[model samples]
Target: MQNFSKALLSWFDVHGRHDLPWQQDKTPYRVWVSEIMLQQTQVQTVIPYYERFMTSFPTLQALAEADQESVLAHWAGLGYYARGRNLHKAAQTILQQHQGEFPSDFEAIVALPGIGRSTAGAILSIALQQRYPILDGNVKRVLSRYFAVEGWPGEKTVEAQLWSQAQMLTPLARFDDYTQAIMDLGATLCTRSKPRCDACPVAHGCAALAQGRVAEFPFSKPKKTLPVRRASFLMMLNQQRQLWLTRRPSPGIWGGLWSLPQFESREDLIAALNPSMQTTEDSPASLVKWEEFRHTFSHYHLQIEPHRLDRVQEAPAEWQGQWHDLDKAAQLGLPAPVKKLVEQLEKEDGQNG
Candidate 1:
């Protein structure tokens, strides 16, 4: 066994997390779901989501049979809606192509909608006991510091180097435990900030620790100011306290999720509500402009100005949306901001009543 893997395994045997929900079943489906959820998200945050999701669809076949909205509703607060959408698509694909079986082959697994190189490796190693190297965020951080690798890990060259190191360090035996051990090492001791080097099993050989630059390895992405974009969300509420919501088109931000009617500007929103600006009593003259808030995406900042239109009898003819009770609307597959907004509005409505 490689010294690195041996040390990691020793530590894992003594201190690694063994009781995680996904660890309990150790099935490919469970491991795949857990891996996908863990992408760019903390384990603590994913625990409840994972448990709820497992309850909703315990088996790959069950997930395959579920609707996209139902699957996404289970993933509403997890962010990265595309992961949820792709997961649902992958499950359906497996059902159709693999007869509801999680593919055992690496290439076949990677071909799935959301499974990438690292995720595929993890699923195979942890669930199938296959000997494959993973280069997930946690692994990258661990390997980068171990080798004192310099450069943003996102760069192709840097990532390739890390992959090679990960491949070299992965041992021939106990592949499952080794896979989980390295991830635990990163998540627990070799953390992004304030790493516990003293407790790190392989700290003796960590190049970054030797060089006194543990934080500098796995260099950050080149800084770029995230551009800010503005939009107006039209919260059209009717007399029954029902809000109009439209499903966003797929393959984009908040894709396949329900959201409030959105326009490029407040004028466009007003024009939609009162196209002719006639001075009639029910011309939506009392449009209430709510305070604007910012919702940051991975690439940009969305400055959202919200407008509330009340006492409307009907939705705009052009908007093909449904009017849902505020509480009921929160139950649908909604974007995080939209879900929070719905809950906030619902709470205020209750107080007012």
Candidate 2:
């Protein structure tokens, strides 16, 4: 254990990341925000979002007081709206329950929305300098290769073993540096592909490298083909040439974000619009049919087909959508697919005019 801690910390003193934005103050608020943004996202990708987010809502009270739309707008293009929503909800929870102070208790910290064991540990150790072990992706990779642990890390048995190993290796002194050092080692040297074994501090003791099976230590999950689903998006246009969009419902994909009106099929959308659309003014033949595209998720593939409905005189009150200028709509929180569709509309209008 001494060697484990010394080797990594020694390497970290020279090569570890020291100048991240969240590390400057090491406040619980900043650490929590950075950890959420870093989930399934690269360090480079999170820097800009973190900067803009801090600028907009610098404190927990500011985040709690802001509306959901405002929060989502700041998180636009980040590709995970739920995290932003959860962060806002957690802020409100902290003020209501914890008296606006970040809790040091493990249970209380983990109870916050969107924060798990690993994230809780990271915040407590990295920011507050408490002694806690984290098992994020980088740490998982490093431990798996160093000890040659087998099976997918997601498995319950494998996860338990990894947690035990992480806790065992975590030193009581300078845990702050140890936590960051292991993660930095995995990210920079012990990478998923093309690991720089020669530069690694623990390369001499790496079981996978010695056994010539470094790639197989962290076993991959079983592969299954993603199921395909279909939906029709009605690109309704009003007299002002503004697009009509609806705020998606929560507890589903793109929840709480403004998006195009969706129907199960083109027939369903047309049926809803036939009553108000004037055939002589805008016939089905004149309707522009944009090319279809697939937006792939982790478990499913969404086939999005965009259909144009121009000069829409009356909106279906049941749909509960509002009209917005294209430029203004672009500024709002729209999903990546919906945003791309808007860009496509912009290009088409420019060419036609």
Tens-digit per-residue lDDT, 1-353, candidate 1: 38889989999999999999999979999999999999989999999999999999999999999998999999999999879978988898899999998999999999888789999999999999999999988899998999999888888899999999999999998999999999999899998899999999998899999999997978888788576888999887877888989999898889889999998777557657754432246554468888899999999999999887777777756777899987798899999888878888888888988
Write the residue-wise lDDT of candidate 2 on 1-353 in tens digits.
77888888999999999999987888889999999999888999999999999999999889999998999998898878879988998898899998889888889999988899999999989888888999999999999998999888877899999999999999888977888898889889999999999999988888999999998868886566566788999888776778999999997999999999998666556656756543335444246678899999988999988998676776766778799987667788999999998888777777876
User: What are the lDDT figures for the candidates, one per model?
Assistant: 0.88, 0.87
lDDT of 1 at 42: 95
For model 2, the local distance difference test gives: 0.87
Alpha-carbon TM-score of each model against the true structure: 0.65, 0.65
Supply every candidate's count of residue pairs whose N, Cα or C atoms clash at under 3 angstroms.
0, 0
Cα displacement (angstroms), candidate 1, residue 89, comes to 0.5
Clashing pairs in 2: none
